[model samples]
Target chain A: MKKIQILGTGCPKCRKLTELAEKAADELGIAYELIKVTELDEIMRFGVMMTPGLAVDGEVKAAGRIPDVEEIKKMIA
Target chain B: MAECCGGGNRLVYACSGGADVGEIADRVARKLVKTGFARPSCLAGVGGHVPGFVASATGDVVNIVIDGCSVACALKTLEQVGADMTHFVLTDMGLKKGRTPVEDAVIDRIAETIRIKSSGRVEESPASTHDGCACGGC
Candidate 1:
């Protein structure tokens, strides 16, 4: 199963990112475990300074801003 | 340098761009540090997305951002990370972008102005929250 991680502090954008990531993973039919990292220390461990960061399998794909659903699909896939 | 007071720290970041006003902004930030009114932090690190630096920008600290002009590159950089900052523009403070001279006197004046204006209790940014990343754009 793919480990899909969303790094944020539960802000509006963070929630949006979470929703989009789940949608992308579902559409791709990927077996994924969604993890939300809300702690600053945990988020920083991924070396991301921006909000609504996305990570796939322990690797950060985007940070500081929200990526479109299409872009998120690419990352998860 | 002021005995590391208990009420959190005042972290200063300067634009330090290529222009003359940028130079002034850089010096002003340093002067604030030297006078013990604030501490110097890295704007470049935040801009470069260094995790530790970005983490440090948040929390119980006051972020003072200095910009060379209305361009506000430094402010934008911090904003990208959803940092809450008190911003200042040299041009808005009556310093000409290219014409301002980088002098200790000028730096001192600006630093004093900032120290005075930024004085008092720590002002919490309306955007700051326990969870952090309060930009609200998401």
Candidate 2:
């Protein structure tokens, strides 16, 4: 199972990123655990200075803006 | 003795979103500059992580961030770039998010709020010596 984490303080864009990430994961039919890292300290541990960061299996795949679903699917894959 | 933002100690960022409040934030920011209340700031530059903008936001000067409503786009962008800024939300100033008409009175009121932080010249102190002219250039 892949662990997908979205890092942010749950801002509007962060919530949007989570929604997109879930859509991508469900379509792939991949057994994945989705997590939202909202705590500032925890988010910083990933070395992501920007909110709306996407991480897969402990590795940061994207940061800052909301990536499109196609790009997110690729990241999860 | 290098100058940042044209040597101005006050910087203001407006929420340039696509809503009534957003437009109010933007107009208020421009009006502030026009009246010498603050220097202009780029919300996009801060959000995009531009080094120059980031430096100013986190610099010694005070950065005033204005948002149209509770969405707080300008404030968040500044936070992302590690900019410790003073913030003002228009809706909090009695302007309803969708109903407030954008006008000079509204813009001036918002600008006055930010201007208060720097000095007491809410409407600019009258000339020390009034020039006796009808042009009102005193």
Candidate 3:
């Protein structure tokens, strides 16, 4: 199962990223675990400074900006 | 160090290029560290996506980025890791990139400029983003 981690402090962008990431995963038909990391400390542990970061498994694929659903599908797939 | 004394960590990263201004930027960052204005951190680590290094740059800490020229490699690297930073460019301070002399006096002047600006509100770099790069022939 892919572990999809969203790192953010619960801003609008963060929510948008989460929604997009979920849509991408569903479209890809992949089994995944969605984790919301809202704490600053935990978000930093993922090596992400910008909010609304997306990580696949344990590797960070994107930070500081939200990638579109197609882009996110590529990240998890 | 007054700004960072009672606050979180202040990490300094310099562009240390192969030019004269690069040397000045490096020396200024070292001076900042020596004078306790900030702690020296690794730009290479952040570029390589090292988790610990990236984490250190986040949160309540202050990431001070000094670039030698308009290339802004140091600033770009930290930005990839989502670091919020105050940036400076030596060339923007009237120092020519290749023509400038790498003197302690010059380094001190630039360092003082950084110290003064950093002590108060953060100054964003004029060319802060990848879009600012004109290497695409645009």
Candidate 4:
């Protein structure tokens, strides 16, 4: 199963990104697990200097902002 | 993040920063809950090291992390707690980080993304019980 993680605090953009991710995954018909990372210490461990990041299979792909759906599909695909 | 069952009860957390993208993420999360896509979870609880919150986050449901920028503060939080997440970033969506104008079209696009993602999952049942934590005060 593919693991999808959304990293951020409980903010607006973070939540929006979460929704987009779900859509992309469903559209692709891939089974994925989604997790939210909201702690400061935990967030820092990923070496992310910003809020709202993206991690796939334990790897940080995007950080500091929300990505487009097409880009998200590419990341998950 | 609180874990329930299926995407209906899936937890969503955002960076909630003071920037434009942050606001967008926050708004999107609210819209997702209103539209019955996923249940809004507490990001602070996970950040504050609340045991119950952490325990709830561990399970079979989807946990979403949304961030406004590349700092990925929210993503790091979950990682620190040893929890996995399906992450998204606004900057990656072609939205510039930092101060920017919030547009309705942008918000609509974000909402559409969420709807598309949750299309095949269990639709949030109308009879589904609401814990009333959408405000994250729990």
DockQ of each candidate relative to the true complex: 0.13, 0.01, 0.11, 0.02
Residue-level lDDT of model 3, residues A44-67, one tens digit each, is 666564445678887777765678
* CAPRI quality of model 4: incorrect
TM-scores for all candidates?
A: 0.56, 0.52, 0.55, 0.53
Give the candidates in order of TM-score, highest first.
Answer: 1, 3, 4, 2
DockQ of structure 3: 0.11
Q: Best-fitting candidate, measured by TM-score? A: 1
**What order do candidates take by lDDT, descending?**
1, 3, 2, 4
For A1-77, candidate 1 gives per-residue lDDT tens digits of 99999887776767888999999999999899999988767876766544567889987777655778898999889
Q: Candidate 2, fnat value?
A: 0.00
Between candidates 3 and 4, the TM-score winner: 3
Residue pairs of candidate 3 with colliding backbone atoms: none
Task: Show where candidate 3 strays beyond 4 Å.
Answer: A1-77, B1-8, B121-138
Ranked by lDDT, the better of candidates 3 and 4 is 3
